[model samples]
Target: MEYPDSEAQLPLPTLESKPEAQITKLPTRPRTVFKNQLVDSTKSSGSAGLANKKCRARSLWYALYLPQLSNLDPSQQEKYLNQLAGLMQSVSSTVSFHPQALICEIRSSLKYFAGIDVIHQKLQLLLEEQLQQWGLLDGFLYAASPTVTGSLLLAKSGHNTLVYQKDNLRSALGGLCTDVLDLDKEQRRRLHNMGVRYLRDIWRLPSNGLCKRFGSNFVNQLNKALGKAPEPTCNYIAPPIFITSYELPYELENLDRLLPIADEILAQLCDFLRRRDLSTSHLHFSLLHEKRDHTEIHIGLRQASRSQQHLMLLLETHFNRLTIPAPVIAVRVEVKNFDAFFGHSNSLLETNSLDATHYKDSKLIQFIEELQARLGEDHVKYVSCAAQHCPEHANMQLDYRGSSKPRLKKSSAGSISRNPRPLWLLQDPVRLNINKGRLFHRRVISIISGPERIETHWWSGADVRRDYYVAKELKGSRLWIYREKGGERGWYLHGIFA
Candidate 1:
């Protein structure tokens, strides 16, 4: 409560008068550990495995950096934290302890466990398990996430498995002995000299000069018990990453025109990723397009890729409805989650696209993407099979653009036939009504081929059931035509030789 109550005082380990703290520890003696799904316990808690292996397991894991280590030397604690960090992915802040010690909290093991008790127990076991090698501080383990308040800890005594409820967390610690607060000997003497005692008393201080002068240790402690502040049992992770942004020159409604700008920033992101050797698995794209919709496009990558082109493709595809909400203003791309580029090690199969070699393809892609800029990406590409036995597969399409690129794909038949495809087929199949199969379209049927059956899709309503004839025309050329044999009666030029 670091406030002005006229009775302002700091609690110390050896109170000058052996006075109790005014603060109230949450009652823990009667607490029954119950699972609280709200808290993600498994990932940091290492107790689940122990429970699985042994019927009952109890271990105390205390998350302390070098300074927090009451027993170990400061240098030794730092050395151990560094060693432990190699094995554990931790998130913590290390500050020099007054006694010249350091502190770190490792919590990567909690996700796999079920409850906090199990996690706490497992962490305890881990600390004790490694005490012989690392020389820990009594192998005691405390549970809590970091809080905006302070780095103070909320600990559960013993090594037994026990679940933790969201509401019960306060009581479990409130009932704790005031000693867990661990006021310094000097601070204790100072407080005891004033005849003050108990966490409840010190916590009740008003917020004003006390907090302004003494700092946040008091408020932070209360926040820890109240849980408004997270006391995570984590180790030192990385510092929070920062992203840069620029103001848009103008509002951009077209996803296409924004490509260059996006490319520019994406290039920057690539550089950052390369430097960090990281790949963004998920990203958030903010588009302040126009007066219509200032949208945020959240994309989950099918595969984590740091490639500029791949990311562009995904973003371009997503702006399907990226109409300018307010005539387009600015755009920002932020990474929500990132992972180290796992397999970016040198590989021959990796696609290489330097500025010089890939310039043409990049330009081509850019040009093809222009339509997506002008008109929403509704009709970029269409997929239509050519001849039944063609090698080219689906023809170039502008309508089937939005079909998502699948992760796993199977082969499909060719759109055009491989039977000597023509160099220049008329857009509309030419009509040369044959007289009893007499050819005209530049060639005669010196040799006639079978009348293969062709059918149209029924659901689309443009049904076509025809018998196609491959005939060498009166001239020295070959042609293809389909004479509707079922519902319609007409000879239409389906295709012709080059």
Candidate 2:
């Protein structure tokens, strides 16, 4: 009675759940079929099963593409790419460049940078700052994938996707347009005729057919993008030569006035070396004079270094000994020799000891450089050992800047005798007077270590046959005395030991 009946009180059906008779079905058009049909991905013959496998260490690569670089000339493009490569070295040791892209292996760097996400954040910020400094308007696009070609293709297509896993690389690259591939006009036309608009469309075609029509190289390139084949790349190596010049507002003859300019140039060079992780042991400075030949100054370091303070100190030493020949209108600095920089790590336990050692070594080198600059390179010499058996020919003096390095020639026999040798050898061996079997340098001396027989130089006309002994004087001074075997058969004082 309450409602004419519970069934009669039911609500009317909505559009979602309408009665079959009330709903009308619309007629649909037939599906459009292109000339080529999409093949089954599972049956892909060329790179079959590659997308399902995991990427090896060498497979993970990151690519950055700068569209603005294409607008530059080839030389300018190379220079810019080199600069960018140096900057990228901070994140990855292996960096390579393409026509408009920079690619690096990131698998080894992921842990150091925390992860791919962190690396992306850091590189994005770094690149943005660099581009801004360069006055580039259009920003760069980047992609991380399992294959270099895959990452490059994704980046070039303006898709900033990151696919770190191999399993996701193919799918990530599938949607990219076919034009991203390096194709000739004829190849592009053929692809368009085949209705292959995207990479996935090409993948759909039979591999054998694609190989026969497009050639094996093209097919192999696609396979590389899918991690089926390895991609070989030449790493970008910055040129060893670093040259910078500064023009002075006015000509100056005094070296003191010219030093600030040199300092500025050296600062720039050190920054360049730091960015590239390089060091140079030799530097050339030119003092430019208007309408005259420039004065050249050369500075040499005992070891490779990039420290501005050290380099400037050497430069100052050279300037102290130098006299400006003419008024300098400009200054030029050049460095050609480069070496990899290896920074020393400090020890927590032996920090003081290491600091002392480093300080002592640095002071020694500084002293040598200053002496060489003041006394001339030839006058400042270092004694080095040689391979000759004769005592006179056993040691030679070498200049700091000499072309001849202290390298001993390979001896066919085993190493020379381990017997002690004196550091101070006389230019002429003084004939020692032997009285009652006692060797005398200035006073009577007693033999401490014996009579080691040395008979060598027989091959040469001047044969050496002597019995050498270490004798000590009354004052505790050690003398190296040798008794001749032939000729005069006399005793001679050859060397002295400190």
Least well predicted 10-residue stretch by lDDT in candidate 2: 18-27
lDDT of each: 0.49, 0.76
Q: Compared with the true structure, what per-residue lDDT tens digits does model 2 show for residues 1-498? A: 111112242243342331111111111212122112232222221263254233223446899999898889999998888888877866776788899899987765665666677787788888888888888863788888878899999999998887756667778888999989999899899999998999988878999999999989899989999989868787865455676566666678788877766777787788778977999888999989988898899888776788898888888888888877678887778788888985666766766776778767766776787777667878987776677677788777877763346566566124555788887898999898877776667788888897988899888887899999998988878989898999999988889987
Best by TM-score: 2
RMSD of each: 22.3, 23.9
lDDT of 2 at 328: 88
lDDT of 2 at 265: 74
What's model 2's overall lDDT?
0.76
Query: What is the lDDT for 67 in model 1?
Result: 31
Q: Per-prediction TM-score, please?
A: 0.33, 0.43
Put down candidate 1 lDDT per residue, 2-24, tens digits, no spaces: 11122444443231222222321
